[model samples]
Target: MAKTYHHPKHDIHEDAGSMRADTKSRTTKFTSRHMAVYQAAAAFAKPPSRAWRLVWSAVLSIVTIASATVAFADALAVPEYVGSARCADCHKDAYETWNKSHHALAWTAPTAGHVLGDFNQSSFTHKGVTTRFFREGEEFIIETDGPDRELTKYPVAGVAGVAPLQQYLLETEPGRLQSFDVVWDVEERRWYHLYPEQELRGGDAFHWTGPYKNWNGRCAECHATGFEKNYSPVNRTYASSQAEIGVGCESCHGPGEAHIAWADPALSYDAEDWRGLSSVGLTMDFGKNTEADIQQCATCHARREPFLDGNPLPGAPFHDSYRLSTLRPGMYHADGQILEEVYVYGSFLQSKMYAEGVGCINCHEAHSADLKADGNGVCTQCHSSAGNPEFPSLRLAEYDSPAHHFHPAGSSGAQCKSCHMIERTYMGIDGRRDHSFRVPRPDLSVSLRTPNACSDCHSDRSPAWAADAVAQWYPDGRHTQFHFAQVLSPARLNPDNARDDLVDLAIYDGLPGIVRASAIDLLSEIGDPEIAERTSALLTDPDPLVRAAAVRLQRGAQGSVAIQNLLPLLDDPSQSVRIAAAREFLNIRAVRLPSSVSQKLDRARNEWQQSLVAKSDFPEAHIVIAGIALATRQFEAAVAAFEEVVTLDPQHIDAWTMIARIHAALGNRETAIRVLDDAIKANPQDISLSLLRTDMLP
Candidate 1:
C-alpha cells in the first residue's frame, strides 16, 4: 500500500467500475515442478508438546490459528500522515461533517468536549462491586476493583466513542491500557456496566482489566488513525502509537501530505497527451474505484482477525490484510443472519446488495456517516418505483408500499429496516441493525429456530404464527429461494454424516465465497481422509478464503500425502492462503519437503512467522509459536512461549497443563509440581490441571 490514503469524497462515484485485478482470477500460475519430497525428517522426530499436538485437533477452535499478514511486506511505501488538520484546509465542509461523527470521536485523549461520562462522583454497582466515577483536577478517576481485586483509583487516560455509551481507558500497568467495563449511558445520564448480565470480576479474561479488554491490542486499531501496536514481546509491554487520536481524514482518504504535494499548480498536469503527473499522486484513483471505499471502511468495521499484528496497510485489498470471520455456528445463524456483534462486513457479504456491487457509501453519507436519507427514504433511494441504473437486476417496483410489505404506512412493520435489517442489541444497550438485507424468513425461523423479524416484533407470537401469517400473505412462499441454512445447519450439528453434503456446498458456485469457505472449514472435524481428499480440488479455487479453508483440512494427512497436496499452495498468490499452507507444512515433521520447494516455503514461512511475531501480544499467537518451537526440539523456547500464553491469559488450561507436562518430561519433578500448584490456584474448577499433578506422582 502507498503511504497515502485515496478515497476522495468529490471523486468517488457509484458506478459499475472495474473490480480489483487480483479478484479477477482465482488461480495464479506456478510452474509445474516435480520435486522430491525429502529433507531432515528427524527435524520433528521428537514428539510434539501436548499443546503442539492439538494443532490438527483443535486449531479451528482457536480464533488466531490461521492469522497471517499479507506476503507483500515492505513492498509499498507507507505514506506519511500530514494529519486531518491539513485536510480541513482544503475541504472545510467535509472535515466539519466528519469531525462531528462518531468516527472522529472513536478514540481520544480525555477532554471536557470528548468525555461524556458523569465525573461528579457518580456511582454504579454491578455484581456486588460499586465503582465510583469522579474528577480529580484535570484527570478523570475511576475508583473500582483493580486486577488484584483490591480497591484502587485509576486515572482515566483515554476515552472511546461519544454517543449511546462512552468507555474510558486507563493505563493500569506500565505501557498497558485497558478499557473499563463500567460505561456511561449518554441518554439515560447514568453509569451502567456494559456486561451487566455477566458476573465478571478481576482475573476473568473478559474482565475490564484483563487481556481481552486491552485498549492497545483490541481497540486502538479501529478507534484511532494510523494505529500501530508496538508491543515488545521481550519485556511484555506496549509502546502503541497512532497518527491522530480518532478515526480521521487520513484513515479513509489516505495521507494528506502527498495529496497536498499533488495540488502544486506547477506540478499539476494532465497525462492524456503524455503530460506530467498523470497519477494525481494519490495511493489509488478513487474515480473508478468501487471497492476501495467499502473495503477501506471494512478495515475498521469488520469482525476479523488481522493478517498482521495490528493494522495492515489500510488501502490494500481486504483479504491481503485481514481474514474475515465466516458464518460460524456461534457468531451467526445457520441461515447466515447476524447472531453476534460481528459488525457489518461479514453480514454485508451475505447480502444480494454486495453481490450487485453496492458500496457502503451508497446508503451512507461518506462524511457524516449518516444514512443518505432518513428512514424509508434511504431504502427508496435505490428500491424506488424505478430501480437504480447501477443495478438493473434489482426489481422495479413500489417496495415501500403496503401492497408489498403487507403493513400499513408509518408503522414499524412497514419500515424497510424492520424486515430486512432486524436488529439485535449488544453491549447491553447498543442495538445494531443487520446489514444482510435479507427478506424475513419466518419459515426458516420455524424449522431452524432462528429469529425472524416478525417474531421479534410480535413477542407473543411464535415463529409458527409468523410463518402461518406469511403463508396467508403470499401463498407461494413469496420470494423464498432455497437457502444454504437447510444444508449448513445439518452440517454444523452432525458433521460425520454431512461430509458429502458439505463437499457439495463447498463447491456451490451460486453462494458467496464466505459461505463456501465455511463449508470447507467444517470438513476438518469430519476426520475422514476421503472428505479431506475431496476438498483438495478447492485448493486451486479463485476465492482465497475457500482455498485457505481447503488447505487447513489437509492437516489430517501426513508425510508426502500432505506434501503433494500442499506444496503448490506455498506459492499461492493470496498471502492468507499461502501462510495457511505454510503453517500446516511446517508442522508436518513426518516428511521433509525437498530443497526444490524450499524457496517457496522459505518466503511463505517467513511471512507466516512475521504474522506470529507481529501478534506476539495475543495469547493465541503464542500457541502456534510455542508449537513450532516444540516441533523443532527447542525445548527452552517452547517453555518460554507456553509461559507467555499463561502470562497473558492465566486461565488458559492447555498452556498451563502443557507447561507442567513439559517440565515433568524433562525430569524436573519439583519444578513441575510448583507450576501445577500455581495452575491449580488459578483454575481450581478445571480438573485437568489437578490430574496432571496427580498422574505425575509415583
Candidate 2:
C-alpha cells in the first residue's frame, strides 16, 4: 500500500503581502513532508547549506533538479545597508575601480564638477519650443514647459548618466523628481531633446512630469542604493527615499552590515563556524562560481515587473522579486532580436552562452562592470585556437583570424560582437548591444523581417549577400534547432496551420520557459476549438510562466471548460500564476458558474484585485484594472478606470479605444465617434484609429 501525504490546507486571504507570505510558509511545510526523500539523497548534497533543500525537493518530485533550489536563504533576516564609504576602508582596490566605473557615476548630485552639461545660458529648440539651460546662483536651472504647457524655470535637482548623454531631474512638486525631456550630449557638447520629432506637450503621459518619466517611481531604484518608492496610491504621491544617491557597493553585494559584523577582528569569519551568523555573515553571496551570480546582476539589468512591492535584495531568487518579461511582439522582434528598450536579461536568456553556464562576470569585471578585455580579446579568452577543454561545445579555431571572418584584419566587420551582437540605439543617443550572443543569420532577416548584425553595418549590401557569405563559410545549414524564432514567427503570422506546432512547442519541456511561454501566448489568437482543447494541458505546466500564458490561450474556450482549466491554477504556488488564472477565470460570467466554483472564483478575483492595487502607481496596472472591470460587466467602474488611464497618460491610445468601445456597447454611438475623432486628432498618423473612426462614421 502506498502512503499519501495530504498538503496542509491554506486559508487564502486579502492582504498586500498575504499571498507571498502564505506561499513561503506552505513551501516550508512541504519540506518536512518529504523527510523520507531527504535522507535518501543526503549524500548527493553538494553545498551542504543549499543542497539539503533541493535534494529533498528533487527526490520527492522525481525531477532532475537544476543544481540550485528556489528556497529563500533563511539564515538572514532583512539586510541592513552599511554605506559604501564604510567598504572603502578594507577593499581599496575594488573601491577605486568602482569609483571610476559607470555604476558609481550612474547618478550624482548637481555639483559644478559633476555637471557635464553646459549650463551657461545654452539653448536648444525642438518643435518651436526653446529650452534654456542656465546657471542661477550656484544652481543649475532649465527653462522649459511645465506640466501646464507654460514656459517655466525649474532648478535642476540631480544628474543621471555620464558619458553619451546626461539627463537632468527637476523637482516639479515637493519630493516629486521628474526627468527633463531635454538632455545634454556630453560627447557632442550640445543640448538636445530626447523626443526630437514628437510634440509631446504637458499633461501627456510621456511628458517629463508624467508617471513614466517620474524618477522616483520609474528609474530611481535601479540607479540608487537601498531605494524605496514609498508610493501612496490613495493620495497619488511619492515619498521616495534611498540610502545613497548612486549604485553603491551594497547595491550589488547586498547589505553590508552583517558582513561588517562578521568582518570585525573579534568575530569568527570561518564558513564552517559562522552558522550562527546571518547567511554566513553575508546578505548575498556573489560567488562567481555559483548560478546566483548572473541573477544578482539581472535583478536590475533585466526588463521585468517588480512583483514584490519594495526594493529587492541583491541575490534573492528572481522569481520571488520580479516577473521577467518573455519574448513578446512589441518587446522583441520575431527573430528574437530586441526591438524595444528591453534591457539585456531577456535577450541573454535566449543565448547559447546562458545554457552553457556563461554569466556576466565571464566577460566583465565584477567591480568595474567593464569588459575583461577589449574587442576580440574577450572572445579569444574562450574561443582561442587552443580551445577551452571545459567548454568543449565551443567551435574554437582561428575565430579571430581573417579567414574565419572573411573580412580584413582589424576591420570593424572582423570584430566578434559586430557579427554576433548587433547594436540598437535607445534614448536617442545611447547604443546598447544585444547580448544574446548568437551567430549571424541574415537569412532570417530576409524571411522574418528581423534585423541582423550583418545588415546593421552593411548599408551598401543586402541580406542576401550576407546570407550567401555565411552559407559559403559554414557549408552546412546554419543551426536551426537553437533558432526558436523560425517556428515562433510562423506560428504568430499564421496560427491556422501552425496551431498544432505551437501546442507542441508550448508544452515541450526541452525548451526554455520563456520560449514556451511565447509560444503559448501566440496561441491566444487561435479561436480553433481543437487548439483550445489541446492547450488545456499547458495550464498545469511545471513552469509558472507557461501556466500563465496557457491561461490566456484558453480564454476563447467554452465558459465551463475555461473555468475548469483555470480553477486549479488559483492555488498555484506562484502568485503571478494565480493572478493570471484569477483574471482569466473572471472574464467569464459569474452567473453561469456553479456555487462552489463561484466561491473559489471570488477568492481568486479578490487576490487578483489586490495584486493590481499593489502596482496601482503604474499606468499599465490601471489599464489592466480597466480591462477586468470591462470584462465583469461593471460598466461605470470600467469607464472610471479607463478615464484614470487617460488622466495618468493623456496620449494612451488603448485607453481611448476602450472608452470608445464601451460607449458604443452602451448604445452611445455618437459619443464613440467623438472619442475616436479626439484620439485621431492627437495622433494623426495612427492608421488604426483613422480606420476605426471611418468604420464608426454614420
Candidate 3:
C-alpha cells in the first residue's frame, strides 16, 4: 500500500483514538512523551538474535477473548484467534497467494530475507547529522543521536513495511518500540530522512525517537493482527502484543478459529453445529459483502483519528471506531484532491465510485491486495465498451481509447489513472495515488491554486493552457461548473466573511458529506450566531459526517434549547454521531430531559469516555478527559488527568499552565507557585514558561 508520514502537528480530532497508518495523528502535542519515555528507559541494548520474526508461520500463543464473554452470549461464541498458518491447511490456494505479498511482510523480525537495507557499514547524513546503519552479529544496529542528544547505538527490534520504503523499529525500552524515522528506500537501496529540510533534536515531536514514533501507540494497530497496545499510563510502560506480527488472513478475513473448526469438523466435533454459526463460522464473509470487505481493508488503509484503541476485528463498523478526517486545510487541496498522506479512505469517500458501491476488491485482488490489472486495464474492467455486469449504473463507453484521452495510444496521458487518480510522492520514494479518483480540473486549479493532473504531466505549462486544452477536448463538461472549492477555499482563509456562503454550502444538496461537513466545521470556527438554526436541516442528513458535524454546531447552546437540539442524536445509529452528540451534552448541566433521552445521554457519555480512554497513550485524550472532569466539577480528577498529561508530555506547556491555574482556583497559592516552578524547570528553554512563572510569583 502507498504510505507517507506527514510532519507531526497539534492534531486534536474531536474524537479519535490512534493514528492508524498516517503519522498525521502523531501530533506535536505528544512531544513531551518522548522526554517521559526516555527518562523511564535505561541504556540501549543490542537487539537479540532475530527476536522480531514474523509470527504467521505458526501460532505463538492463544488469547481467548471470548473466555469470559462466552457465558453471556453462548450461541454467538467469538472464536479464538487461530493465526494465518492454520488457515493454509484448508485454503491452500488463498494462503499461497498471500504468503509472499506485501501484507504478509508488512512487519517482521529482521531475519535474513526480511532485512532489505544494506547493513554493511552504510552511513547516511542529513541536517548535519551522520547516522550509521551497520550489522552487529545477527542484529541490525543503528548508531544515531539518542534522546540525550548523544550518539548511541540501538539495535533494530523490528522492521515495518516492505516496498518503496521500510522503517526500522527500535526497542527504546522493554515493551516499547519506537519507529525510527531514518527510512530505507527499498527501491533506491539508500537511506533517507523523512524531515530532510529541518534539523530535529531531542524532544522534537517529529524526531525519530519521539513518542509520535512509538510503535505501541501508532503502528502496531495497522501492521499486526489481533494487536493490543497494553499501555500503562500510570507507570508509563507498555506490554504490547499481537496475534501475528504482520497483516495476516485473520487481519482481513476475521479470526479463523471458528472457520478452521468449521472446515475440519474433528476440531469441534462434539460441540454445537459450527456451520450454524453466523457467517458459517467466519466473523464476516468479505468475499460476498461489499461494504464490510471495504471497511475491513480500511481498518489499516484510512487516514483518520481512531475512536477506540487496539485493533478492532475485521468487519467491525468503521464509523463506530473512527472519526474520518475531512478534507481539512493543509492536508488536502481546496478542491479535495490529496495533498498529504491521507491513505485511502478519506479520498475514496469523495469519489462517485464509492457512492456507486465500488469497493477495494473491485479493482484490487483480495489475496495479493494489488490491482487486478495494471494501469488502464484496471479502469477498463468497468469502463470498456461493454460495462461490467456487477455495476449496471456505469455507462458503456470506450474509456481506454486514445480518442477519449486525447493522447496518443500507449502514452502516459492515455492511461486511465494518469488523468484521474494522479500520484503524489510522499515519505521519500513512496508514491501514493489519490483514491478520490477525481477528473482533472485545471480550470479550478487556475482559480483555486489546487493541483491538476494536466499540470502533473505538463509541468512547464500554465493552468490556463491546460484549462483551454481541456475545454477544447470537452467543451460541455463539469470543468466549467461551479465547484465547492469556490466557496471552501476562501472560507478556509476567511470563515467570518464566508459565513453566508458556508451556510449555503452546508445546506446544498448532492454534495459529498465531507464537503458539507467541512463547511459546517468552518462555520463553527467563525462562531456564526445563527449556526444552530442555519444548519438544522443537516441533523437528518444521510451522511454520518454531516450529522456529526451538525451536532458539533450546537455546542454553545444552553438550557432546554441545547437539550432539544442535541438530545435526539444521543441515540443516533452511527456511533460517531452519538459520540458527537454526547460531547455536546457533557457540559450542559441541570437540564431535564425525557427519560429515554436521559438514558441515551448517559449511555452515549460512557461511550465517548471509553473511546477517549482507548487512546490513553495520546496526551490529547487526557486533555479531553480533563475537560470532562472540569465540566462535572471533579476538579481534583481534572488536575490528576492534567498531571498525567505532563507525565506523558512534559513539554506540553498548556497542560502545565492548566495545572497551575486549577491549583490557583482552589486558593492554594503556594501549591500553584510550586507547580509553576516545576513547569519552568521541566521546560527551561521556553521563554513563555519563564513568563508564566514570573506572573504567578507574588
Please provide, for model 1 over 140-229, each residue's C-alpha lDDT reduced to its tens digit, 9 standing for 90 to 100.
899999898988999989999888889899988887999888888899988887777888768877678887788888778888777778
What's the number of clashes in each of the models? 8, 0, 4
Q: TM-score of the candidate numbered 2?
A: 0.81
| Steric clash count of candidate 1 | 8
Worst 10 residues of 1 by lDDT: 29-38
How close to the true structure is residue 450 of candidate 1, measured as C-alpha lDDT?
80
Q: Is candidate 1 or candidate 2 better by lDDT?
A: 1
Please list the C-alpha lDDT of all candidates, in the order they appear: 0.71, 0.70, 0.73
Q: Candidate 2 overall Cα lDDT vs. reference? A: 0.70
Candidate 2 ranges with C-alpha deviation above 4 Å: 1-77, 265-278, 288-290, 389-392, 479-483, 527-529, 536-543, 556-573, 588-607, 660-698
- Give lDDT tens digits, candidate 3, residues 1-698: 00122322213563211111111112111222222322222111221212111110000011111221112112334466889998887789999999988999889898877989988999988777789989878888999987778888999899888898999898878898998878988888888887688787766655676767778887788889888787764456799878999999888767777777667857763235432234457655776777777877876787766765577656666776677777788688888998878888878888999888999999988888889998788898898889999899998988878779999999888888889999999877789899989989999988889999999999999999999999999999889688889999999899889988898989886787888888888886643337777777788888888998887676545446667777768778777898888776654566566766666666666456545545677776676766666655666766776776776667778778888988988988789889888888777788987787677778
